[model samples]
Target: MIFKYRKGDELIEQTVVKPYDSVFGGQFDSWNVGKKLSNLTTCSNFFVDIISPSSPDDAPPLATLHFPVYTDQNAHCHVDYLRQFFKIADFCTSGDACKEKIWSTSYPDPKSDIFVGYDEDTQTLI
Candidate 1:
């Protein structure tokens, strides 16, 4: 989710990052699900874990980007911290990859170019 581009951790590339993000493992899922009111504020965690440069395949992640898995304002801070990395390992998208491809948001951000609020009413995401 974090990119080297100007946008920082907030990824805007819908194509380059879309097709390559997701996983389904019972073991991994349980551990990553996080705890309630614990350090793991989210019920579920989704992020790209970054490994050290020139490091081995099994090295722990140096940083990560939990861009889309925050429960509240506090978790938002954690997401931001992890989004400032320069390098990352494999993928971790939970279900983001299936979002836009399946359907679009009828109520997009007002600042976004694709905004389709209630006032528009003319077009629904399809």
Candidate 2:
């Protein structure tokens, strides 16, 4: 994916590669060994091109198997939430500076910490 960030008026682009499997039903995608090897070789070559000539250190060894384990549902959920939060943060912080404003008129001050009744069952943030 190409991520574009603005420095003053100029835009800088960065490319990030996310390796994943093609067969998994859930978020943890599986990749074939051959395909993984190919991707690693390509990445190593790219790194070689970018590193300075003085730093002739060879590319770090690549892992043979790529597997991310989410131990529990809560861990998986938190990861998904963080991904969404970053997207929202990017939009909020990009370009011009913006201020936070509360829209609800029902509460005297929506921005202030006012106690609202919570449900014991769900333990939700209200």
Which stretches in model 2 have alpha-carbon errors above 4 Å?
A: 1-34, 37-50, 56-78, 81-87, 90-126
- Candidate 2 lDDT: 0.33
Model 1 has an lDDT value of 0.41
What local lDDT does model 2 show for residue 102? 28
Clashing pairs in 1: none
Q: Quote the lDDT for 117 in model 2.
A: 59
Candidate 1: C-alpha RMSD after superposition: 16.5
Candidate 1 residues 4-51, lDDT tens each? Answer: 111234332321122233473222212232353245443343445544
Q: What stretches of model 1 exceed 4 Å from their correct place?
A: 1-44, 69-126
Clashes of 1: 0
- In the order shown, what is each candidate's alpha-carbon RMSD? 16.5, 18.2
lDDT of 2 by residue, 1-28 (tens): 2222222233322333344557753333
Cα deviation in Å at residue 81, candidate 1?
16
Pairing residues by index, what is the TM-score of model 1?
Answer: 0.20
